[model samples]
Target: MLPLALLAGVATQLRAEEPRPAATTDFAGLILHLSEDPGKFHSDNFVSNEPGYPSAIEGLRALGIHGGAYIGVGPEQNFSYLAALQPERAFVVDIRRENTVQHLMYKALFAAARNRLEFLELLLSRPPPNAPEGESSRAAMSVQELLTAVDSRGASMKACEQTIDSVSARIEENFGFPLTDKDRVTLRHIHSAFAEAGLSIHYSSPKAVKQEPTLRELMLARDTYGNHVHFLASEKDFQFVKQLHARDRIVPVTGDFAGRQALRKAGEFVRDRGEVVSAFYLSNVEQYLRGAQYAAFVENVRRLPLNDRSVLIRCAFEKPTQRLPGDHSEQADGQFWPHALLLQRAQRFVELYDEGAFLTHEDLARQDYLDWTSGR
Candidate 1:
């Protein structure tokens, strides 16, 4: 193992980007071909905890970010970026095989439902949306109202049981991708977590010392203009992601950022398809990429096809030094908000590294990035 230092000789070996031959295959074959074997990660991130991710929408739009390949880490958070950018294609790359398995669960959910409300029914294990009872037509309700209605009804263990079986069947029918027994088990476990917890499920369980934001809160979150911006915020946004998943355009791969193969293969796939990666949701993965690993990660990034408009989406998080009223929800919940999404020019990242500006993670969070986000 290398110490936490980048060797100058390794830096000197960086070469210009080159294209790799495209593999001709369907969605299942593509996933199996592109992904590395299962790797280990510490947490079970079934739902995202980034409450302030809507700010990323405003930032990306401000920077004219849109339409190309979208690469991201984590669970469902990438959906919001997909909705905003309307990317031509997407890849969710993470070290955990569980993350990839969970994505298969999501693919099943999207495939089962037609619109946003029906999608929620399949997710929370609610009985199918029925005749007008307590609420009006499902289409008439706002995102907030839909979430509130679902939250009021307790999760049905009976429905959850049925949901798990259906998800398993759907995976076999739709994708036709062969999953290992462990992968199938992981898929069912992830689905059960969402159904049992309903909208209240979070990054960690609710009983933890620091309670994280719930799925309901995350979906209800708003952009800088106070417009709801999560993936389920609007019917159009929801449909965009739904169709993509049904078509298997959004692929999830178990890939270690610092390791070999996965990312490099993804870059090659993008290059061969003639698609440029417009937005990449880093989500603080750089914090873990130090020393030679960081250098290797940077090299992997440089392999992607990019244009001048491409940007990297990252979230900045911390523990408060003193009790300050920055955001009311954190104080009220007695938990820290692990996010405020920030943007950096993808090309600028490579340029800054060459200039010796990104020696530390702190250096990645400079004010100039803020300026760049604002078009200053």
Candidate 2:
């Protein structure tokens, strides 16, 4: 019963002295280690920032992925999902070394950018908008508005190339991540791809594949309930991812989702920190995995610290009429669509492994994960 002001001051001091949660791993050191010792797997070049399946957002939200830790295979879509989940930490795992380099490029940009508008400006190497004089004012612009401004003042080829090189140099010199000549070339190519295409870059563009949705379309995509689900759809979501990147919480590792090294190490890090993996986003990687690879992936997942609430969000391409053993026949839609489904990791591992059902994508897809929440 001393003075009330004295008691308040003591309380503030105690709160200030409280211990914070230690980082599970040194982010930069871990990236350097993983890049130096990559897992034994190969993935083809996927330079575009566009996601293969934009509909995964529906499944992710349906599963109630709130955030602890997120591990995913792919490019920019992982960032989009991360924005939605607001995970405490994130790891982008891919088999391709170039993918890791691409992520590092993104990290450098994120670190360099002051806000979402500035991020897009730096990404495409376009000059910032003239109207917005300060960071606060520039950040007030919507994602779409920012894109429009950049699109209006397109970068020339020489300018774009120079910008790419400057950013690459910043990553190597300032960030302290050494880049090989080959890595620099690949990084330049990636940055050029974005600059050339602007917001309309797609997975199939310039490569001249069939019709594909642009990155802008994917970012503007809505969930099953017709809500805008893309990360850049809201200012809060964009800031959420940007803040995480600024904190060095979003780590990019060069490891296959089904590989031995990356996932195992990620699991160990999460376990060491006494944290649970909230969700793992498998974006149609199972379609390409062989039987043994699938098994190894499942085992790797099993090693992660997970609770009953942990979920696996999977993307698959299948016709509505295609049926597997024990798969229920629903109304024929007569079209192939990318379907996103969720499964409890512990439960699915036991069921699929025991039944020897990991042989094919169809085998995994046929299972009745309908009991679990899913959107599309």
Clashing pairs in 1: none
What is the lDDT, from 0 to 100, of the residue 150 in candidate 2?
Answer: 70
Query: How accurate locally is residue 269 in candidate 2, as Cα lDDT from 0 to 100?
Result: 86
Model 1 TM-score, 2 decimals: 0.85
Alpha-carbon RMSD of each model: 6.9, 13.6
297-372 per-residue lDDT for model 1 (tens digits): 8888888898887888776554333321111224324445644566777888888897888877766755336432
Give the candidate number with the greatest lDDT: 1
lDDT of each: 0.72, 0.63
Instruction: Estimate the overall C-alpha local distance difference test score of candidate 1.
Output: 0.72
Clashes of each: 0, 0
List the candidates' TM-scores in order.
0.85, 0.78
Query: What residue runs in model 2 are displaced by over 4 Å at the alpha carbon?
Result: 1-26, 35-55, 128-143, 205-209, 322-346, 370-376
Across 245-306, the per-residue lDDT of candidate 2 in tens digits comes to 77878888866655557888888888889888888877556665556666777778878888
Error of 1 at 318 (Å): 4.4
